[model samples]
Target chain A: GFAELLREWESLENEYQNTQETHQLYRQKLEEVSKLQESCVAAITRQRKRLKDMSPSIRKCKQTMTSEEANTMEEIQALIKERPNIFFEMEAFLPKKNGLYLRLVLGNVDITLLSKQSKFAYKDEYETFKLFITVILLLFAFTCQFLVSNRIVDVLFNFLLVWYYATLTIRESILISNGSRIKGWWVFHHYVSAVLSGVMLTWPNGKLYQMFRNQFLAYSFYQNFVHLLQYYYQSGCLYRLRALGERHNMDLTVAGFQSWMWRGLTFLLPFLFFGHFWQLYNGLCLFRMSQLPECTEWQVVMCGSSFLVLFMGNFFTTLTVVYHKFKK
Target chain B: GFAELLREWESLENEYQNTQETHQLYRQKLEEVSKLQESCVAAITRQRKRLKDMSPSIRKCKQTMTSEEANTMEEIQALIKERPNIFFEMEAFLPKKNGLYLRLVLGNVDITLLSKQSKFAYKDEYETFKLFITVILLLFAFTCQFLVSNRIVDVLFNFLLVWYYATLTIRESILISNGSRIKGWWVFHHYVSAVLSGVMLTWPNGKLYQMFRNQFLAYSFYQNFVHLLQYYYQSGCLYRLRALGERHNMDLTVAGFQSWMWRGLTFLLPFLFFGHFWQLYNGLCLFRMSQLPECTEWQVVMCGSSFLVLFMGNFFTTLTVVYHKFKK
Candidate 1:
């Protein structure tokens, strides 16, 4: 019995020692990791300096260009292939493992779709296609909403919203992967809008639907109008700028940008703000109503919450961008 | 009459010359733009060379860290505040306009939530709170599903999905804004999922709902189980790695990552694949059936399409990541 007790104590001591050693090993590895992170940050900082030097060009490009284009695509791809290390160097600056993640995802897609010279053209082509499809769909929805806001029309619009946004999300993602400048928040904004549109489409023709139909239609009209303006303004700017020889510089500054386009955006901001505020008010109204005891379905609650989140996110993000731009 | 014709010809000639001059002006601008782009690319190349020199540090960082940590918040904020130029320099390398967008959005949010020393501690604290709340909710849902799979439970779960995903989306966005590398696709993925869950929750307990109940339950179970597994694996890895001092590096390499976690993921992949395939099949099946005259509601078609989209997106993304990692 005494020998057994002594053996058990020795086993416990060995287990503790092993645990201590493992902890020590992990700690050492962590120190190595931190040192590595510092170097990565340093590397990122150096890369950033290079980018800063090109700010004038970048700003010029932004003034002229609307979004990623065929020429820029070629330039970016050429750089990546010829000097993969540049991508690796800049990788330290991006979030988490996304630099590699993007490379891997895009690399696979590029192999399939971007065969050679055609690849750069793909994005431009896609933009053209997207714009064409969007215009057609928007026209269709406007006609339906204006002429006959019936169940079938609502359902049709819902289907279109789902399909269009899904396509937009997919395309936008590809663009981001291909080094386009669309923000995460913008993509997220699209997603929330999609969900709201989908919910609206599915809403049955009831008293609630009747109450909100005009407001909803007006909101859609405003959104589509803004999109049309943005599309044209951006495209025109890009065409002229590209013709002038500016490429890969979309800094969205007042300098070098067409005065007319700036004026148009300035004029449009109030409408956008009004629409955003209306969404906020609608959400508040719905949320208040949903609190009533007579509310049979939780759909009201869910819908209200969705509106709140979407309005808050959209309002905050849009305002922040505007405030910063205006402040500057 | 002859004198009048001569006058018109002279006017036309003047107009033609003016057009030619404008065209020439555009051509000059185009040349300037091209030269700017070239210089920007050259700058980027130089930066890349510098980064290449620090490859060992990059590689080492990649091997050790799981993702961004709480500590880097201060460093990133300070960099953004002090040398915003660095952010701008790095901007050219990122997807367009994100640098400014991120600064505007995060800078606003940071002022509210992140105060001095507490800023770094906030993420960890938030993560802990999220985990605690998630566990409680998951347990409650599990109990409800297991014991009472009724309309109430369905509604409850729907609410939970919406609330959870919305919260998660908001939090992930904040993290992204603060230089976290969570992908845009992932956020979009959750939004689609939330919409799907919401639709399912609202579906009346009828022929379609009855048909889908068991399958939906099983699907939900698997999804929740996988989420639980992922949470533990990710959290455990992050905690241990943090203790070692690594931050903002998540390479997903096998070296420092726990083998069991990899093994678990590998084992789970087939099941996930199977689930994805089943979703596709279910979508096809529903779509085919919905085509029949008896199917009055188009909800069937919408749900089917949603499933198809979700399945394809998830499958392709997952396969791409897995293939890329494993091949390496």
Candidate 2:
């Protein structure tokens, strides 16, 4: 992205140099204005004399001049004096030199979103809000699943998942509408999660649910806990940056962000990797179940595969963004 | 987006004005160069004398001259002359009235991607390629279904659906890797479709499959036909624009694009609406079936709801993009 900006800058610089050279040439021409004006006057006088000689012969050939030709000679003389002056005036306004160069150079620079080096509006506040909600929701879900295991509890947690993610999708859309740095992929991630959770809520109680119930709850609990940790850490960094009046750098808190990386690498990433692998394991398990003669839970295979897609997508996206930011 | 460009241009102009004023000031100072040089020499001599006076006292306080004291007098004299020269050099390089103003203004102009007024990379080419493959695959499946109505044919179509959408997901990922404008929702869309088709392939031959079989194939047929028409028309416009040496304009051929709007509105949109409504009708049918006593195909309800989600997502996305392009 910076590559495009750099290229644009180079072109603008070249245009500026060209315009400066042109301006210097024009200035030189202006320096000899009196001499040029004298030459023009001489040329005009010569042309007038030639026309005068021709006019007498023409008048002899014709009967009389039409009314339209009454001021033809006088008008021609006036134009000779005025035309060059007007030409210079128009040329001065054009982008060849002076003020026009500014327009030419600036007009061509493409301003993109990623290249936006400006302070983002409501960036920290939005992140903080997101963190607050994530912490509350995750804490609630983690507690509900950890302490209690019932159909109602399962339903409640699923409802929370749907509501929280649906809310996230809405908030993210608003952020995007405001031109925040959140990518479309991140928003879609929430949409998928929302749909998945909604479907999970609708899943009928059966043998498949009985087998996978504890595993699913534990996986979700760990996920929420990791996310909760991340949100708080990120929020803290953002708040500190905002308080220090580094508003422009709210998104780039690298020093504090390193701590997040440390925590992730040492603690969260292993668990995330485990979860990713576990999703594949789940898929395999479902596939094996589909092969069993008595199993009627073939739909679990679809669920497992979608979960695999989500996990893989999440893992890859996280890695990419982290790599991108870290490299920067 | 051009609005952002105009704003940037205005700011650059303002900076140019400021630099111009600074350049005028510097030029005035340069005119009295000899006078300024004399004052600089006087100041250096005075500072050197003052340092010498403090040297003895500082030596008395310390055992020997520290590293800082070694170059005190000479460094002070050198710096007095050097500092102003360096300042002038730096200022000259900075944006200022005569020549440097361009550099200053251009350097500060921030170009962002969403704000990008520049030409995008060839995204349509990749999408066209994707559409081409989709059309071929869909047409093949449609033909197979029309000619043969056995369980094998059903499985064949399902397999085709799985493979095609999987390829789409992969291709979309590659496009995203290359920074095309394709969003995450589109990738997720393909992923969901791929998984759905996989599930459909796995669905057992039963009363349910028999009931939904013809409807699904017809839907697929119409969907592919609409997409094929759209892709060809769009690709033609892009190719023409490219041939005409309007590479940057390949994405923004609204004059040529109007033809697409006309076609979509008159011909393709009706079919698209029909398919969309049909998805809803399928959902309603599945819902009613779930309410019936003997019906055991609760999975259809999930299938139908997901279909509804997919349809709504597709419809909204198309509407949004069209509205955005039309508004532009």
Candidate 3:
């Protein structure tokens, strides 16, 4: 019985929709006829008024209201009464003009888009998906890096870090020549935002932070590593410039070289100083841990390992720069 | 008698200096004349060879070398025997063809210097000096940040980091547009030594590394912070594009908005998720420390204080973004 009632109700809804649509069509036709009748009657009336003042011969011709004219006037009146107002038509739906300013300022997205024929960025949805997947996997690689404990893992990870840093620096140099010199101010701005975001994510009231707090150091380290890579990038670029200049029998670009140096210095100096103090503290921490009977071998290993990696990376990077110059 | 001998020795040294300078000048003149004479001879010889190989009339005339020509030839031979070959005249040290190429490839740098000027970057002198100063200072700051015993200092220093990062990013973006739109690549390539000179600072190794190895986390934070800021910058630009589209009744730009959102998502999501984990770890450390008997008041206060600053700053930034979004 319930099924029958539901079916009946659905049928009723369909019937109602059909009836409403038919009624609307009828009303629209009626409105159109009424409007036509009204316009005809108004025209005839205006002619009758003019007929009152016109000469008799002219009046006998155009002034005489024929039955056809009377019929047309009646049709106009009927149409006017049945139809909707002209102004009420979907006039608001039409596009408005914000004038020439918008046209000048904005690019036509349709023109610029990477559709079937056009090639621009953000096209190839498949590629985006693949890129995103790769990025996710990379993030996972970062995760495994911190979570695991082994000498091979440690060595491999730091090596990877160096590689990543070197590649990024190289990329940046390429960009610098290409005119994508990321300046000091921009880096500073992004740094502030990232720190703030980290804090926000970790806020006590937030669930995200509730699951992740102590990892701040590690996470921050990874982040800073990327940043350092960027720094080296600009530096390495300048390095190439010097080398290329020599090859071409040109004097080194003294001024441009210096500017890159300044920007790079600002980034490196603070980080190096921070790392220096950390080394001292880390050494002290390891020493203090030694006195504690509860200290585990793993704790000592972590301390010893991080310190070694940190120092080695910094030392070799500096030495590389010097050695490169000497080699040159 | 010893004083008299010393005076005589000094007089001999002065006389020697004068004689040496005179000899050097004479040698330079002889070298110049000889080189010039050789080039002239080569040019004349080549011309004579070509003429001799050509119609006999020209060859016969060449055989009867003029008295003036013979005189020039004799003078050139004498000087060539006495002097060394120099490529171009010293006044224009660079060969004319190569100099013109360098001038066209790069702006005039001989007259323009790396100094306080309208240079795209800090001039060369300031660059090296600034880089040296900042790197040392940055190493200091990085080290200090790790101490984590002063809340106010951490916040203040982070703020400074933010400012620098911002400057860097802005410069980078401008470089991109400049490089592509105008022939600014030439300027950058010429001035910056093809963008390589600005990146890695070569230095004596151990000192720089030993100084910077300690405070890895702080440096890492600064780096991550910059990436987050990039996320915001990309998003903000897209948001404005959306606004313009809506205002101008152009629905096509909605695609642009989608792509921008996609970009920001890729940019920030990693940091956000990674940061989420760190925040939790920090909390655990903070909480555990609070319960520990060995925790110093300074350590507790500074750590707690750093958290508060980060939290507040993040909250305000979120609020700023939200408020602007909904406000008329």
Candidate 4:
């Protein structure tokens, strides 16, 4: 019996020792892997610094060149202009530095996309959120237009718009930081939209508010419809282009048209122009309202100016994109 | 002139080739590093699975053993209970899966901390945010109590509280996903606080609202003061413990007391207990108001119940933690 007990103790000891050894091995391997990862990250940081330095050095070098030298270096100039894309591609594994907006809100939290899959996944989520919110906003605008006369309901809808655009701006910034080729104006457009909705939210329920409410809701409904249509068409185009190696996979379905979106999406142009004109109409209405003796709220003037700016930005950007595409 | 042009071209060509080769080498190294990172991640995932399996196998083995055999395996059972800590340490470099709240809100975005420094930095940021908001809330409450009685002002203050708690819950969830050892109840407390603030925001400017408004503001002011004090003390204690290697660096400063917070924090007990009782008093006041004939708002009863829940949770958790610490 004593010998049997001793044997049992030895077996348990062997199992315990094996478990400890395995744990030790795992810990050691994890430590080494982490060290390698740190070195790799440091290498990336160093490379990014060099690339950043390269731009300034190239610019300085160009300034020292003669006119003839500059002419001869035209190809180099073009390549330098395309350096940002190359930098983005090379820094795919590096942790992204937050933009000013994100730094202000999230306080420099690391919002890096460590893998291509994760970056793509985040971009897809942004698209889905946009699509989902657009549908809800469309339905809500419809209800506010036809079924609801209550100020509370209108306030709720405006609040949703404000929140939606705010979220969109944040998501878009994250996408851009992850190497999404979203142009600057599109990101700025969301900030303007957010401010417009916020002003709308603060507008008091009065005769002036009542006068413009229906038209505003109607415009929102129509705009959301156009957005839905654009989303479908642009996403389909994007999918095709991505598969054919013609577009970056992270390219988003923006609110306004870009030159690249001209192919097979001409049918959506009329609707976009109509929405743009409606924005102008809204601006004109607000401007008239702000001039009225009874209009005392600063929100009236602010909303008018915001709408005018949005109209000009959207209209001109779309026109330029179309004109460029037509010229080509 | 032709000779000079040829020399320039040749120099440019050499520079371009050097740049290209350097980029190619960097790309190759990056590729290799990422592959290694992926394999390391895979190994961690497998190890986690095996560790998970070990628990069940140990349980099954214990069930099949005689009482004497089970008695002999007590040390192994203890080690099994400590496995979660080991697993967390091992998986520090792995991407974290979102908790349910984050999944519902952010939809499975990767919130992984790839380095220990980032994790600690995030935790510090969270503490700073809490402190900053606590001060703002305290000042806002004081103003509402002494300087302003406008319903709009009250609504704004309540909105700030709701937004603050909502943000805290989201950030706390992120911290938990990143392996901060925040207890579950503390996260749930923020959710309840958010709901409470939301209810308060919806309460109309009526007789019942006026009845509870000053008391609520006073309580908020006092609670925020206690939070500020607790933050300073807890963070100091954490800093010391971290320096002494007695605490994890990622541990956060929570609102309520914990067993580990008992040493050198006995003076904070009275303030905490008083805050708990103040919650109970607020709950009782709301319950009494809700029973009045003029109480028509559903928010009164809801606020009453929420306050009661907060009181009970805070009181019991603190009591149990203190009791445990005393026994130890």
**Using lDDT as the measure, which candidate wins?**
4
Better of 1 and 4 by lDDT: 4
Write candidate 4's Cα lDDT for B61-118 as tens digits: 6666777777766765676566567657755655666777665455556677656677
Off by over 4 Å in 1: A1-130, A143-153, A201-206, A247-258, A291-293, A323-328, B1-202, B205-328
Candidate 2 per-residue C-alpha lDDT over B168-278 given as tens digits, one digit per residue, 9 for 90 to 100: 554454334333456567778776776566556544567776777777777777778777866766566555655555533235444665565466555656666777677
Report the alpha-carbon TM-score of model 2 versus the true structure: 0.36
lDDT of 4 by residue, A206-274 (tens): 789889988999899999999889888767765665555545533345413344456545789899989
Name the candidate, 1 or 3, with the larger DockQ value: 1
Candidate 2, superposed: residue stretches over 4 Å from native: A1-205, A237-328, B1-214, B234-291, B296-328
Name the lDDT value of residue A34 in candidate 4: 51
lDDT of each residue in B1-328, candidate 3, tens digit only: 3233335435534644453444344335434533543444344344334323433433343456777655644553454333222111111111121133222212121221111122223222222332443464455466565565443343344434433332233233223322212233323322222111111111111332233223324534543464445435544653465365432223554666646655765676456545534543443455555566654333333343344344344445444544644342
Each prediction's fraction of true contacts recovered:
0.00, 0.05, 0.00, 0.06
lDDT of 1 at A121: 52
Share of native interface contacts present in candidate 1: 0.00
Q: Quick one: how many clashes does candidate 1 have?
A: 15
Q: iRMS for all predictions?
A: 22.9, 24.7, 49.4, 7.0
Tell me candidate 2's fraction of native contacts, as a decimal between 0 and 1.
0.05
- Angstrom error at residue A276, model 3: 20
lDDT of 1 by residue, B1-328 (tens): 3233335435533543443444344335434433443444444444445334433444444444445532343343343243234433332222222233222211111111212123234456445645665676667657655778776666566656655664455455544544445567677777777667656644655676677666666666666666666666566766665664554444565356546547767777877788788789878977886877767665677778888988988899888867765664
DockQ winner: 4
lDDT of 2 by residue, A31-74 (tens): 34324333433443444454445444544433454544435534
Question: Which candidate, 1 or 4, would have the higher DockQ against the true structure?
Answer: 4
